[model samples]
Target chain A: MAELVKVVVDAMGGDLAPVEPVKAAVEAVKERKDILVILTGQEEVIHSELKKYQDYPTDRIQVVNATEVIETAEPPVFAIRKKKDSSIVVGLKMVKEQKADAFVSSGSTGAVLVGGQVLVGRSKGVERPPLAPLIPTAKGVSLLIDCGANVDARPSHLVQFAKMGSIYMEHVVGIKNPRVAIVNNGAEEEKGNALVKETFPLLKEAEGINFIGSIEARDIPAGYADVIVCEAFVGNVILKLYEGVSSELIHKIKDGMMSTLKSKIGALLVKPALKQTLKSFDATEYGGAPLLGLKGLVVKTHGSAKAIEIKHAIFQCVQFKQQRINEKIAEKIQPAQFPAPDKE
Target chain B: MAELVKVVVDAMGGDLAPVEPVKAAVEAVKERKDILVILTGQEEVIHSELKKYQDYPTDRIQVVNATEVIETAEPPVFAIRKKKDSSIVVGLKMVKEQKADAFVSSGSTGAVLVGGQVLVGRSKGVERPPLAPLIPTAKGVSLLIDCGANVDARPSHLVQFAKMGSIYMEHVVGIKNPRVAIVNNGAEEEKGNALVKETFPLLKEAEGINFIGSIEARDIPAGYADVIVCEAFVGNVILKLYEGVSSELIHKIKDGMMSTLKSKIGALLVKPALKQTLKSFDATEYGGAPLLGLKGLVVKTHGSAKAIEIKHAIFQCVQFKQQRINEKIAEKIQPAQFPAPDKE
Candidate 1:
């Protein structure tokens, strides 16, 4: 029999957690019998939430018993240190001990980042574990690395991000030879600050990846590049703005359709088709961002996430585990991909 | 006699420059007699482009004769240093010497930031001169500060930004007690990175401005905040993404409308209304991003700008000059606005 892909989840993490998480966990286990979920939270609170799902396999949905929750207000380092029994820390410990294949959290992002580092550990030869987020685009989804991991990063780090992110997209997400581009003020090679200027040539010279010169902010939604690499500061801003504007646009479109009587009538006539088309704009479909380049996987879902978001996050882990994304990165970095220096 | 509001135009700057700049200068002079536009560029090129505008005031549109043009490829610091007679440099000099009230360019943005610093200088007590770009929102417009001025900035700089941007929005854009917020990953003050955490208290303690706490990106288009404060790198990204996604959505909507005969008929029925609404989404209406907190006014228009964009930029300067935004900013920074030691 194939080994079960046990995933540890911080059930007490998010705003609507325990409830949404329990629903998602039950659904995930129902869909995939080969999967097992270890929900970590206050035993009483989690049990009460999980009681709604009577059909969930008791053995498959075991509780690790985390007593405390990390408040979003606490300093990340302080929270990670003090809240040892917090869901995030406990779930990470499960991954650390190989009790689970991955750890999923819809919790305080700061704690997740800290817990991932302290418990799961960074991958071999990895300078930083970037938060590689899969952003939905017109063409498909592009993996945006360093979305909010390391704020102050170097050029060499960005090069590593490009390579590692390319590995994730190519193997796990199933994109081949992911086109990587450095985010810049302009599309021109010399159009950004010192970091972008330095990273440009390095990314251009990188092998086993399709290095596109540069991409301006406007090209992102159109899916101009498959792997958009940038420092955490830039990546964080882009990801947030991307989420903001897309949501705003959808909200406006909906509002516009509902404002007038005639428009409302028109909206009703086109409701089904419009909803289907606009559903493509939903960022939740892409799942949570992965804290990539870690020994054990950690996925950080949105704090305001619902049951659907949790379900998608679980699905993402399955794909991530099946693809052997890390091993692929090691293989890509082999001396074979790099040419011998003329053998003179 | 009223003193002429002299405007300096970098005629050799922008993609459609010479032609667009000359036409915009002519149109502006016609609109306001107290305005004098000094067209700086290669004399021959200026004359050739100027010939297209037959009704342009030949005497008012004086060609300042710049010998060289700063290519976008050149490093900002090096280009500003070496190209003494470049259009960007000449334009800056015109404003610095009080020959013009404002300097407008659709040229290299980095060069503009460099030239504004090297030429126009900074306002007294101003530690940083933030680039405040006016972005169109559903509720009129918003001022996004530090878009590309200082890449790595401090929490104190953001506090200054909130004051300056609020002043501009109130005095120039005619919004009172303009809601100012620090852009962050989450709406809660406790969320976001170190910079955001540091800035949150300062913003709250800041007086003379309506300091709304952290605002997520998705809230921007629905017009959540009047002034959005962030470091240049983050601000630049948000601005660019807003531009990009809006363009993408417009294209997608247009394409979708043309996909079927029924949809095309639907589009035709709503063509006038849709055109009116979409026109408001045009980037040109807001004109250029002003390098605020400078001793003299400096504006950076889009590089790919045309005559209409130039015309709008010139009008934006008119409002900036007339509104006396700097005086308001100085008032906003009074001792009373700073938090008392006890509060800290």
Candidate 2:
């Protein structure tokens, strides 16, 4: 039998706290035979929540006491440094120490990013680790690299993002030779700001990845590219705007449907199909964003993530470890600057 | 009677070209007696299209001969420099020469921006001219400044954008002391890229405009601020993403609503209310982006603009001229630097 993949989850993080994390871990272990979960949080709180899950597999789940919790509002670097025993820090360290195959957190984004870098460390030859998330498009999903990690990114950084994103999409998301395009104002290479304009040619010449030319933001929803490369500022704006617009539109539609009796009947009839279609666009269905290029896997989900999203995020690590993605990433990223000393 | 507010229409621009431009001019002239439109294009083609409109106000609309047309694919600077007799260039020159109060084009955005700066010239003391467009929000419309004009914008340029956006909103849109906010990835002042971080404090301290600190992209549609300021790159992304996401959502909703017989009935029943609600968010209702801080107004509508949009854009010039927005912009922007050389 294959060895079990041990995953460390920050049970104290997120809005729902120990309840959702403990509940999700219980559900995950029951559903999968080759997975184990280590819940890092205050022992008493975790145990109390675990008791709520009856007929659970106690053997697959363990508890590690973390004395502190990192609040969302606190500064990330300082908090990571100061709160060494916090759930986030503890969970990340377990992955680094090889006690866990991966670390998952739905906590303060800054702290997760800081912890992922400082504690988990970067893979060999990784210049700047980027946060790549799968955003739902009309066709399916496209990976948005450097969504909020490297904001003031240079041209070189963007090229690396495209490379890493291509690796993720090809291996993990399972798209072959994914079409990669730089996000720009116009489709032409001459268009875009200094960063995009400079990065366009480098991406065009980069090895391995299928480099499509520039893509306008308006074409993003059409799923024109499998891998969308952009600096964090642009990526963040696109991601946030996508979320904002979808919710506002749904709100407006619901309001419109409820305004009249005839429409109300129509709403009831359409709710199931509309809900199903919207579910396809829901960010949670795709799981969390992996802080790619880390020495150990670190995934960050939304702060308000529920059991389903958390469950998907944890299972995501199983595939990540099975594929040995970090080794592949190190190989793809830097061929000469730094070679993996351990590899033959 | 008051002197006519002469407007220049680029009849050879946009996808519909002379047909839509001629039709729109006829409608504008019929709607408002105080406005006159100078249709600049191949005089024969425009006249032929004009003949389709029976009993049109011949006295209020006139045609001016412009021999060339600027294609959208042409490089903006090269096109502007070479296509001297193009409709865009001819219309802009009319505004510069004071033969027209404002210039309206649905042609290439690049050409319009280039000609607006070179031909119309910048208002004295204005560091850079920004293309400010009114985007539909849930509450109403908010002005997005520097949408595509100044890509690599400096902090000083953003301050001027905020000032100009404030002036346009208050004078034209009639929102007093309109709350102005800089678009950032996060709401925290320290949380943006280098450009936004540098621009924040300056906007906070800048006088005249109501600076409301940083606004996240997600909160934009909530109508949190009347003036949304950013460098052209970020602003353009926000605007395009807004367009992309809205259309995608509408498309998905329609598809979902038609997938089943029950939902189709619901779709038909809810069509009226939904259409009415969505019309409030339609961008064309707000007219074109006015390249703010120009000596004379230059409004750029979408290339796919129809007759109604063109008519609205032309009438928009009337209000801008009536309010003397340019003189006001100069007074507000450069009170300390130039002191308005010819001020009363």
Candidate 3:
């Protein structure tokens, strides 16, 4: 590896914090020699757990002390301010200070959304920053944007969401000229709520992406569209429901397999393939969602996340580095009249 | 089987029409001896297809002639007004005349939503008839209400949606005292758009239902609650995402299995268990959304529905009959001196 890509992780956030995320961070170091992970939490507690993974390169694994932690219930502004040494706080600061190339957190979703905006700031010229998550589609995975990072979203915001989402899916996920769709109640362009109705025209007029007309939610799973776009509120529901339904179905499938002897035999035979398939569908494989439009990359994992999720998150930084997705996003949003970076 | 429940199907509607739906109806008849189907369409088309099913009960299968077919693109109001001999018009009339217990259609969603409201009308004391669909959940399934029938839904409408959705889940789906919740951005009772924030108190204060605060879309499949209530706009997105995610996962699983020899073996063993489990997750098994609050039962099937979907929709009528779901809904909403359905 040319130079180890550094990723700062919020070790205090998430339900299984420090332990699970720390485990993943160690696992990632073992798997990817080029990845240097800095665990940000209360230094004493984090180092105690780090002792379990002695094989991890001492030079590559460092612990940055963060004494405070933002709880799930605390208000974003209050938590980020009061907990100056919080995992999210110190982790975000690492990216802002160029001490880390990326920041990953399985913490307060509200805190992440706020801190990503207030601390890191949006890329120059971007009007609205969107939260984009890779959603499973028939064509593999499509990036769904605005899953509640912004509410009462405007047309321009959606257009920006489509563009930024498109870039991420193309560069990171490896889909070419992804088909972008504005989620709608109907397939017709004239259909959908006020936001979709206005955004339809702008998305059609957008230059950089493959703008597919309105996509109805029912057709969403039939592997219909590539990059599905919507406001944060709508996107949140789509993303959550998608995850919920996937897990529910998987559980039910396991239940059915255990229902009969013949099926049991068949299930045993297909266990490997089924497991592989389920893994691909697992969202954690892609790490956490990237709060796009930030100057530096800030990815948010679920607060209830465990160690494997953290490991995947650190690995994600490798791809983010390979792509320079942050720089591209900055250029696309701001289109520098003068090449500007690291400016206040 | 208690005397076969007869369902009047609007054969003239739907994309594949009398062929696919007829095939499905025939299959349904074979599967259940308690179903007597009345296929309404162009007499010639119905008989020609029926001839293929020699096992079809000659006395049980009745053909009701309706020559005009209403296309989805047509104006819903115009079709309801002008298409007197249209399949939808005839079917609604049959329900109105009590000749059929329920009318099933895979035609235009807009037309169905409108016709169900205008033709069937809302039951006494119902402010507005909402659409409710049973969506699969880990613990079984949850009903999503106002999934497209009311785009501009008010808080009071949603309050009614919660109560009515709870009742349907209890009586029809056989869930006991179903948990009802409004789909919102967060689980907090204070969260969501103006509609949710304002309407939550109403649902909370309302009697005769288990109002379990708010549920986020992601929590839905986790079976966090029994009745997932929201306006048509949000409901539409939830229902579609539910379908899309499942379909995408299934497709990915199928593709993943074919990737390698080892996986293929695993796929074979797990296929039966997967299928049995996957079937329960299929939205098609749940029939269609009922245009609730209507004076009569009007079921809307998937726009691209085939015969099996239609048969399932017809079966919904049987549950409606057995549970007296409507009567219960009416009683719950109109407690003798309840105010009008709208607090808007």
DockQ of 2: 0.74
In order of DockQ, best first, we have 2, 3, 1
Q: What is the TM-score of each candidate against the true structure?
A: 0.83, 0.96, 0.86
lDDT of 1 by residue, B230-326 (tens): 8887787888899888777766666665656656555555455555566666667777888888777888888887877787778767777777766
Residues B73-105, model 3: lDDT tens digits: 998889889988888888888877778778889
Q: What lDDT does candidate 1 reach at residue B42?
A: 98
Per-model C-alpha lDDT, please?
0.80, 0.88, 0.80
Report the C-alpha displacement of residue A40, candidate 3, in angstroms.
1.8
For candidate 1, the docking band is acceptable
lDDT of 2 by residue, A62-82 (tens): 999999999999999999999
Measured by DockQ, the strongest candidate is 2
Sort by TM-score, top down from the best: 2, 3, 1
| Backbone clashes, each candidate | 2, 0, 14
Stretches of candidate 2 off by over 4 Å are A335-344, B335-344
Q: What is the TM-score of chain A in candidate 3?
A: 0.91
Per-residue CA lDDT of candidate 3, range A157-259, in tens? 7888888988888888788888888888878766777667778987887778899798888777665667889887788888888877787777777787787
